[model samples]
Target: MAKAFRTVLGERLRRLGKSIWWRHCTAAAFLVASLFVLPARALDNMSFVVRGGEDELTESFRAASLLVQSWNDGLTDPQTLFAAARADYGRLVGAAYAEGFYSVVVRIEIDGREAATIEPLDAPAAMREIRVTIEPGPRFTFATARMRPYAPGTQLPPAYGDTKPAFSTAIVDAAEAGVDGWRNVGHAKARVADQSITADHSADTIDSLILLEPGPRVRFGQMTISGAERMRPERIARIAGFPTGETFDPEELDTVANRLRRTGAFRSVALQEAETLGFGDTLDVDLVVAEEALRRFGVGAELSSTEGLNLSGYWLHRNLFGGAERLRVDGAIDRIGGQGDTLGYELGARIERPATPVTDASAFVEARVGREELADITLDKIELSFGLTRVLSDTLSAEAGISYIHTRAEDVTGSFEFDMVALPVSLTWERRDNPIDARKGFYLQADVTPFYGFNMTDSGAQFKADARAYRSFGAEDRLTLAGRVQLGTVVGTSLAATSPDFLFFSGGGGTVRGQPYQSLTVPLVRPSGVTVQTGGLSFAGMSGELRAGITEKIGAVAFYDAGFVSDDAIFGGNSDWHAGAGLGLRYDTGFGPIRLDVGLPVSGTTDDGVQIYVGIGQAF
Candidate 1:
């Protein structure tokens, strides 16, 4: 009985193995067939060809047509290809018209049949070829052009009303220029009322008659506020400095929007003129604002070969007291590498009130404590300060402040402690196109501070000025030349009697890169026959950079910096000058550029060789 059972089991196992082999063969055959048939069924291979035009015009038309771009990539469906080609006819015609080809003709054919004559339902199941032919007819020129009712003193462009090419874009641009001419002279409601244009096919000429309505010069009406959620509406108006009851000027509205945006209180701010004129020839203004979040925080980091890694962070409250008052706390630590005891740290807090007592004026209070260890000195300090800032104009401002400081400092000379009070004043004038990546304009900053020390029985005055200019050239202003000059001086006290932080020392990333930080100083010889560096009482520095954009997101920079530090209030023959040259790479981000700079000292001590610095924004 056992032998009979074994024979039956063997027969069943044989049948099972045969069944599995058959199924495997079927699957392999099916996969092989799909490899050949799948792609042909899924993809619609179409070729697009453009003919009958100059190379520049043909390329422009092709670039403007979505159909060409799609066909170049091989569309996957016949319906999508047909739709794109049908829409491209209008786009191509418009492109020709923009170039003054008013009588141009565009023809599209699919598989030897005109696309326009074929119905969608009758289209071939698959499109194999498409051809576009363009006949850009003789260009038309303006023969007679006239615009009426412009306000007095309106200055239109010279090209306006001239026998120039009758390009569609040119006509639209002229109309806009006419409206702007009136708007510049307080006609806030100026607009194009009507336009009559006639094309003469025989002569290939166009005649244009544009009518403008320069409504009566108006004054500014009361401003209405909208879209204020967390911020008070009254405060927004006050901060905007609405020019109510004055002649309407577009520039004033721009200024108001800029001021509100600079406060960081709003995400979006728009100043719009009312749709209808208000009473007594006045134009009512509306301020539409979107407030940002009330609280924010950020962190930043930097690296330098000489200064090591530095990290900083800040916390801010935008609407601390519901009046666009800002409160911020910030902290930073530097020098992670084993660069002696040169580690440094700082913590500070500040509160600011915008539109404090008057429009365009602000008040702030700040307190800080910090410790620094440099090659020449180590300092621990605490300070309290309060200040008032006034904005005289869009590009000018002034500030005055009072501060008290207590510091304990140690140097090669010895350890000393002092208490000092300072009255500081400063003025700033800036007209740069951009604050972070300035392409054109000038900036000037001047500061004067008088300090009195109680513990050291010393009194002195310090003055400093920093001036920078930026100019751009090349296509699209892709190249920027920026130059900076800085000068500082101290009087009424010797360097030893003044606070160490108040004195000047050259050679650092901020002064003369590639050299050690605070490395250039006045030599002081002690009785022990050892010479040590002491901070200088006077300083001057100059820097220049040529920044060129290589692409939309990448740029290159070459820079040179030179600095001088002197023991006397003015430059003396013994003053030491340090200079550095460097190349930098920049990657532009939405906020600014990320910068990496490598510098080498050209005429100074550089024991560390080449120094590299990385940070955000330009060094200045």
Candidate 2:
């Protein structure tokens, strides 16, 4: 069987360089002459010369030579200097070839003697002077570019021939593209069988030919699992979904790794093919997994001027019942000192089993009890939910759940109790470069919960969507512009009948930081014909930030946020809007960023004082 295609992508970047090693002849000679006077321990200078080729090519030639770069930290030992000189001979040749120079001459000398002629084991007692010269004879243009037995529709780089500058990287790229095209079509064992690359110094031209060998189309055989502790092998295989008897695809391997890693049960997953093929010409594969610790715990805290302090923690079991099942319990307490009159607390527990009912989905069950008090409303609720989450793709996922809640509310308008049964469906798509602190890419989340109310409560559906985008510009991506838009609306339910959790509020760190928490509520008439402030039926929010990097780990940002809330479910009548603007600082902690933002209301009737928010991770 032909071997699989394998090449290091970094090999292309290893060939880097710009223009000129010496300005004038006198400077070069003077430096060489003065090197003898410098103390042996104080080796100072070297004469690096590019005798021919463009300034860019010449500069690159020297930059790619180890002997030239060693001038900065002069070699104290003779053996190291001899080794570097010998290595430079081959390194400079490859560097020249990268720039299309096929016939290049590189010479390295120590004390006027050819270092390549000296044995690497021999060391000079003391070194002061060294000389490097690279003569890139001529840049070569491609004469004939050809490849045999390539997959149909595989296109080689257009610049591979005389039409444009010939880069040696183009050859490697062509081979890779050819094999990839074959692999994409189920030829998993496709490979570069043979290659003929020749150069003509007389004409300064290159004639290239590549031959690919596509082995028999193969299917995936059974996968053998190893390195698993506490996790059941059968469950590991089920979670991997290893596609036995199906045509082999490299993407399937990646999907298996992603599935195992997503469960958080494994610290690492590695895949490899068997030494011999299985029955029916199938490729047998092996999965090696390193399971994570059995138990883990973490805690976090956040502070806000209006919302007060929030402390939260969670305990998790990665493997439960010998399967890749996850069990987590979380608790939180808030409102220690803030606008609210009393504190609120919540405790929840969830259990998730991977590869349940579907290969790409997980089954989860959750139960929770909580109390929340904000503005003129207080609610105590008990809830339960059962759901299935599916990983649709690398950057997309979806969830559908049946949720039930029993709510008791006390509002300024009146007291209400509601029992609701809802079906919530949500989809999330994200492609951020970094989730903790994104520099580019976009994120989108949209969900709808349709509910049936019992016990005299009104039935309704709630719709919400959040969209965020980030763009980076300037040198080294020093600046990033981020923006977010959020919208939510409740339909089929009146403001007085909807649960407070389903309603929208337009204040606090999460909405408008400068405004008081839940301060921008809508007024609704009660049965007594008296109007009172309450959560809105419709809401819209927008946030924009300009972030600049001041240092590797420190950053600064300026931002603006605006929110709108309305009593009408359709978002038209009796609306209130508020805006806040602020400045913030970020300290990167490797995993995420620590955030500190100070904000104040800029528009609308809201709180007048500045609000300070301290938390972990980006505000968005």
Candidate 3:
């Protein structure tokens, strides 16, 4: 029995060995076939040589840098760098170098390191310099731009198409215009893809093509709002951007939704779009909300030049009485050097109702007392004020209020005490260009304020206008220019001996990047060893920026800023002015441009100051 079993096992082992050998042989044959059948492509090449003068080297280096910036990878290898120069040189050949000059033989030296050389070979004395002439291509007229439905809907129709023109030489322009039209129709996520532009030089004709994809059209379906149990559903819905009969826009929806969430109304607001709708053109919406704790506490600190050695503490009630009302108490102490010292405390509250749409309003009241000692005078005052503000439109608003004040003025010689009342009215209008993705747009603003003082105090009228324009040179570069002018005049028979110390002033933080606040002010009298305060004139702040993106991430900028406070009496009328110019580096953050600008005074102050600002969104 043992012998028979051994014989069977031996036979099986021999069979297994034969099977393994066959498999190995087959794998070897497959490898050989692959090697013989595949094609061979070269990934490396020989280096080239270039040599020229310092001037030529400088120009050549600039050209090389531009080429490298445009390239996907900034090639540093000697051989690869040589190849790049050779390719660039081919484009320069026969091209006009100057009025009577042209490129001859451009070369690169790559023995140890990469260096480009340019040669401006002179023609024979008998041959006049050849000035190459350039001819403009055929002019293609712009055509009509229209938007068609991406999906069926009963909402508003798109409103941005150009009805008159007939041809568009640039497809990007047409496609962007089409998208703008969709935005007007309340479609915020609208986009154009597969863009193509065709222009026939012989026919002098053009064709613009694009595919429009309007993402989704949503509406206010249902909601479960709880944190504000004291509030009504209809009220919150209207203020939340999903008004009844209102066409859905992704941007508006996103903005208002986030605002509501930030209000600490609910622990969480879960929003989703339904899969189907009763109306073929409508989108069903659903909202699930959870309530958060009604009250909370927090504290924060920041550094600033204007406040000077300041510290603040505060406590907050997120949802006061479960009614979406916000209450906060804060205290602060400030010690300023050379200027003076101030110590004050304030209590403020914000109350709101979720149900009101256009009428929904928030009222705030604050009371404070402070003592300030300046070089010429000491001001100690107690003030109380309240205001009611409303958001009339998405970007427009108005506020009105009244205040009561008691003040005592004193100097090294004497002191006096007085009480007064103030009634103020203010109106504002703002239009944000591209609130969602602001690549190109313009913002316009106008603000007017009128105030009245009781018992021969002080009263005046103030008007301010600000306008900003933004333009993209192409996909990556942008040009932005902004100007703001503020003017105010005191006009009351009961006005006190002088204008209020809190009147509008320029030169610091927001007005000019580097100058100290109100440094532009000029005086008619030399008080406190500084300048005297002459009558005020028109205040002008103008800034211009040119930003070009070499790639999607890196960019460079050149900018100029000029500002002036033209006192009606100083320098015979419009003389006090300051101007600065400089360069900047920018990193494109998806939200907007993250900028760091290095500026130097050009004409006014002797200080070579630098300004750095970091925030979310555009500078304007």
Per-candidate total of colliding backbone pairs = 0, 1, 13
Q: Could you arrange the candidates by TM-score from highest to lowest?
A: 2, 1, 3
Give the Cα-based TM-score of candidate 3 against the true structure.
0.50
Task: Tell me the spans in candidate 3 whose CA falls farther than 4 Å from its real position.
Answer: 1-287, 290-316, 328-359, 368-383, 405-420, 427-445, 475-490, 493-499, 522-538, 547-559, 566-575, 581-599, 604-620
Q: In candidate 3, how many Å is residue 428 off?
A: 4.4
Q: Root-mean-square deviation of each candidate, in angstroms?
A: 16.9, 5.8, 18.1
Window of ten residues with lowest summed lDDT in model 1: 16-25
Position 381, candidate 2: lDDT: 93
61-91 in candidate 2: lDDT tens per residue? 7788776676655555554555567677767
TM-score of each: 0.83, 0.91, 0.50
Give the winner by TM-score: 2 or 3: 2
Clashes of 1: 0
Q: Write the per-residue lDDT of candidate 3 for residues 1-620, one digit (tens) a residue.
A: 12332233233222311111111123233334433332232223332223333455335434543234333353333323333443443333212121111223333332322223211121011211111112212223324333344444323223213332222212334455556566556654566544433433344433434567765553444444444455456545654655444676556556567656746667777666555543534555665566667666654332224334445567677666445666766665543331244443334344444323343455666676766533234567777777777766666667766777777766544554555566555666655466532446566655554555444445554456677666675443444333334344333322123333433345533556555434565443333454433324346677776766667776676777777665442223545677766776677777565655556667676243654433233345
Clashes of 2: 1
List per-prediction Cα lDDT, in the order shown.
0.79, 0.81, 0.47
Displacement of residue 486 (Cα, Å) in model 3 is 4.5
* Clashing pairs in model 2, backbone N/Cα/C closer than 3 A: 19-55
lDDT of 2 at 414: 66
